[model samples]
Target: MNVSLTSEPLRPVVQTRPVPPALIEALSQRFGKQLSLAQVVREQHGRDESSFSVPPPDAVVFAESAQDVSDAVKLAAQYKVPVIPFGAGSSVEGHLLAVQGGISIDVGRMNQVLAIHAEDLTVTVQPGVTRKALNEAVKSTGLFFPIDPGADASIGGMCATRASGTNAVRYGTMRENVLALDVVTASGELIHTGTRAKKSSAGYDLTRLMVGSEGTLGILTEITLKLYPLPEAVMAATCSFASLAEAVNATIQIIQMGVPIARCELLDAVTVRMVNTHSKLSLPESALLLMEFHGSPAGVQEQVETVQAIAAEFGGDTFEWAHTPEERTRLWTARHNAYFAGVQSRPGCKVISTDACVPISRLADALLDSVLETQASGIPYFMVGHVGDGNFHMGYLIDPNSPEERATAEQLNHQLVRRALALGGTCTGEHGVGLHKKGFLLEETGVGAVAMMRAIKTALDPDNILNPGKIFEL
Candidate 1:
């Protein structure tokens, strides 16, 4: 009649609340064929480019309008079921995973360029629109959005991550580009923040708050982004260096001297080798810097000349120029695909990407130490960075099944993050503190700051249904 207890301590049980049958029925009737419970669809909505194991949502709702998003959130709130907003599915930090089981509200169907104000230098778009699409949409007007995060990431996704890319050094990240937003709050209420105006000293900075909230506080339906006029002249080039330290030092000098380089990227020797093989280029297998200058012909020439002198001071060679637009696209395409090239270089290996940003003055030391430490570990890794902005990525290739390899990569990442923090930098420059950097966020921001963040989350989403378990655990 009596049962004996095991000596081992019982693991804490995870309480999973199931979606209410009536709510599911209501959603099915409301969304009709737009709601999908298919396993394939749910699985696809569950994971992103991250190495995290797939945890599919209970259902997927393809929202085509802001009202659809509002209705879905209302239904989820009524049932107390998690609601995860999804865009292009291009995130690499496990931001899209349904860790606590939920319904994914797919906003990709809402893709549209609502309005473009060429004179005002602003564009309004649905959250589902991708960066490439927006650029093409605005190409005719001789203006473009500059927040290119490598991937053709959706505007909503990029805004949620506060993404920045190579051009960020000149045009800034989403935090600066986004002028206004239409957000669907956790309680299913729609609110507008900011306006088409260039600057506003209005009450609370809600626009900035929702820009990088990762859909926890609200779902972005529409975004108004700042645009820049297309430069009259553009030049792209690559310079080779004897060592990573030299390359980074050259970048530091360029920034220190106030050179207006549009894009400045760094690729370690290993990364260049991979890029050569995968991109079919003959780049030298050495530390390299890829740069782009945007301005009038004379201005571009001046900037290039100054950067060339700086590079020469650090033992850099003459730049290999991509003179034509096609050539420039080809070169930047290769740079953007560096992560894929690194993965392809190591057959059957998965990448564990690390992002760290340090002050410009300390970038050289931080990068040099990271390279040495990672190399000492004997792990296959590829390094690339938006050096102009003091942000970089190191993708460590490892067999996902090998715990030893994972541990080695983790150790390298930990050391690099600690070094960055010591240098008065952030653990992640552009990538949000998704599931991957939750612990690092705590370390970077003290307990009090994190507590304040949690308080904000609680105040906005009392039921904790929106993208649960992201940034931090409630």
Candidate 2:
């Protein structure tokens, strides 16, 4: 944690490779209408929620099945053209950008609940199934998938980033829940990793390796994930704090004391104001911790009591309970839409959202200064955190035309990442090292460690054709 990182890099430069005319003709023949060389389709598949705007892919393949993905990838592999996997384009760190020109294989149509073993508490689903869709499919069976990254992102994208969200304090991320994967390697060879069993001492953890590879290694086609029984009792509450420090400190104590709270999210006063106007609710215009507890009624009550006392120690307001399903849904919906709320707060502003996470004990140290620095910089921003597990994000709303504003936001972000690394945390907790964080990845993992990763990528993808120019330069 003491080592200093090199200077963070700017936005990735586009490095488009040539797309063979014969390749396009072959794809047109193979996929017919499913293959699109149209500009709009290519643009739609090439972009995501990130601010970076690169040229669109040369073409897009609307892959509806695993075979379609394999075939498209096989053809691209032959030419060593980049093959970028496109799902629900919800990544904020430029994961979906087509920096190196190629064809985007959009798997949005590959959405189906393949199998459900409610008794075994597991479900197999297609790659393009959204988290909400997966939860809906199993809701009747009293089971749910808890990894909600706020954007209803595709399960395949979530697996690519190893995403976690509000409920991660308890249920964990895709890395923990995903039991197996059907993947198409760079060669377009379909291979299976892991199994549906609860535990496995498999020869190599290919499943884990692929989970957060950011598509530099392979593309996920189908995923089998662990599910949890619906909680018998669920209670939601919001407690306002005097400052961000108090809210974060209270969360630290709750986590340190071993509480099993399902969700603990923090939103700054600025964000609360934005949410108030956006969601049409009158929440206290102050720093707040939104919490949810799930268990038996008595158990939930005990957790509520414990967290309330801990919160009170930090001058938190009396808990505002959301006891009904409608009430809980509304509150969570607003929190999930916090990004949009922030964006709408400033018209014509683009967001550069930062993902920095530190150790539980260092949460206060890591966040308080960043908040002060960002506020002092005079940039419009909204802050939020999953502080129970030491992960937080700040969305800096910058005028895309103003290079000065963008540079200031970048500096603040660079400092924040440095602080997090110094405090025994990661450059990114959930957001993987995409085109934006390639420099930080090296800073956090070091030259030797990243060399190992590059070696693995080369071993799995000799031509660097799968999601090329992402994670790191080849």
TM-score of each: 0.96, 0.99
Worst 10 residues of 2 by lDDT: 1-10
Query: 325-365 in candidate 1: lDDT tens per residue?
Result: 99999999999999889989989987878899989999987
Q: For residues 1-474, could you state the per-residue lDDT of candidate 2 as single tens digits? A: 475767666667898999999999999999999999888888888778777878999999999999999999999998999999999999988887888899999999999999999999999999899999999999999999999998999999999999999999999988899999999999999999999999999699999999999998999999999999999999999999998888988999999999999999999999999999999999999999999999999999899999999999999999999979999999999999999999999999999889998889999999999999999999999999998899999999999999899899889888899999888888899988898788788878888998999899999999989998888888
Clash count list over all predictions: 0, 0
Clashing pairs in 2: none
Q: Model 2 off-target regions past 4 Å?
A: none
Q: How does each model score on lDDT?
A: 0.90, 0.92
Following a full C-alpha superposition, what root-mean-square deviation does model 1 have from the true structure?
A: 5.7
Best by lDDT: 2
